[model samples]
Target: MNKPDPIPARLAALKTTPTPDLKQQWRDLFDSEPPPFNRRYLESRLAYRIQELAYGGLKPETIRRLERLGEELDGGDRSKRSVRLDRDRPITGTRLLREWQGVEQIVTVTADGFEWQGRPYKSLSAIARAITGTRWNGWVFFGLKNHRGRT
Candidate 1:
C-alpha cells in the first residue's frame, strides 16, 4: 500500500494519545483548562494546530462557505482544513471514550441516542454532566466542536 498521508496519520494518532500528554500540551498552548472532551476531539484540534504551523490553514472562501453551511470557522486562515459539507457526522456504533481521574469512561453512539454504562441516554451532554458533575455542552465536552475558530 502507498504510504499514508503524514498529516492525516498524525491526526489519527491524536485519538490514542495519552490524556496527560494532551493535557500538558493544552496548558502550553492555551494556558487554561483542557476541555473535558474525548480523545478524538483533542486529536482533531491538535492536528489542526500542527497543520496550521506547517501548511497554511483554510482559505477565507472556505470559511465563508462553511459558515453558510451552518458551521462557524475562524476567519483567520489558521488551523483549519478543507471543509466539506457532505461529510457525515459520526455514525452509529461509534465508541467515544475519555479518561477521567484515572478512570476510563465510555459512550457508544446508537441509532436513537447514546449508551453509557449500559443505559441509553438522550444526549452526550447528559453523560458528560454525569461524568463531571457539571452541565456541559456535550458536543464541546466530547470535542465534537473546537475551542476556537477554524479548529
Candidate 2:
C-alpha cells in the first residue's frame, strides 16, 4: 500500500501558523535564526522549505545555469549580484505608473535607462525629483522600496 501525502497538509498549515511557531519551525528546519522579514515572507520560505525537505531541491546543473545567468546580468560583479539576487530591480520593458497632483506619471524601463516624459533618465531618483520638484529616493517614491525597520 502507498503512504499518504503529508506535503500538501504541511504547506497548507503555513497559512494559519502563528509567527512565533513559524520561527521555531524555521530554527528546526534551517538550523539557523529566522530572517527579519515579514510574516508573508516567513510563510512562503517555510512552505518552500517543507516541500524541499519532503521532495528535493534544484539540480546542480540548474543552479549552475542560474549562476551563469546572474553573472551575465551583472557581469560577474559580486556587488551587483546582490542587487540582482534581491529581485528588486525591475525588468526591461516594465512600465511603472504613479499618480501625483491629479496627474498620471509614467516611466518605462529600458535596456539602458528609464524613459519618463519622453526623456531619458539615468535613475529613478532623477525622475522622482522631476515629478515632485524635490529630492526624493526614487524607489521609495515609486512604492517599490519597503521601509522596514525604519523609524
Candidate 3:
C-alpha cells in the first residue's frame, strides 16, 4: 500500500502566496468604539443569566446547574438568598399545594385522605401515629393542633 502525501506541505506552500486585504478599502462607518471584553466577568454574567432563566421552571437539569452556579457565586457556600432563588421550583407532573394542612407529610393525596410511607391513614393524626409509633406528639409532623389549638 502507498502512503498518502502530507497535506501540511501543500498548506505551507499556500501560506507563501499573498492574500488580498479584504478590509483595506473599507472605511470606518460609525464613530462608536467597540465594546470592551472581560472574559471572567462575561463568563460570570452568562452563568448568572442562565441561572435566572432557569428559575421557577420545570427543567431539572437547568435548575441543578443554576444551584451549582449559585453555590459558586456564594463562594461555594449556599446562602439563604441562593436557596430562596432555587427553592420550591416545581417539577413537571407534580402538583404543589400551598398552606394545606399536612401537605408536607402527605405522600399521596386520595379522595378521602392522604397516605404516608405506604400506610393507610384516615387523617394526619393516623399518619403521625404510624410514623412516631406513639399517641402523644402525633400532630408534630403534620404541624397541626391536637385539641388545644397548639402545634
Against the reference, the lDDT scores of all candidates come to 0.72, 0.80, 0.40
lDDT of 2 by residue, 55-151 (tens): 8998899999999999998899888754431255688998877766646688998888899989999999999999999998787666565555231
Deviating ranges (above 4 Å) for candidate 3: 1-106, 136-140, 144-151
Greater lDDT among 1 and 3 belongs to: 1
TM values, all candidates: 0.46, 0.56, 0.26
- Worst 10-residue lDDT window for candidate 2 reads 80-89
Higher-lDDT candidate of 2 and 3: 2
Pick the lDDT winner.
2
List model 1 lDDT by residue over 13-123, tens digit each.
667778778877767656787776765556667777878866887899998887766534555554454542124445799888776666768889899989999999988
* lDDT over C-alpha atoms for residue 52 of model 1: 81
Candidate order by lDDT, decreasing, is: 2, 1, 3
Clashes of each: 1, 0, 0
lDDT tens digits, residues 1-151, model 3? 9876554453343333322211111112122321121222223333343344444334799889988997777776644443221223223322212122322333454555555666554555566566556674433333333244432
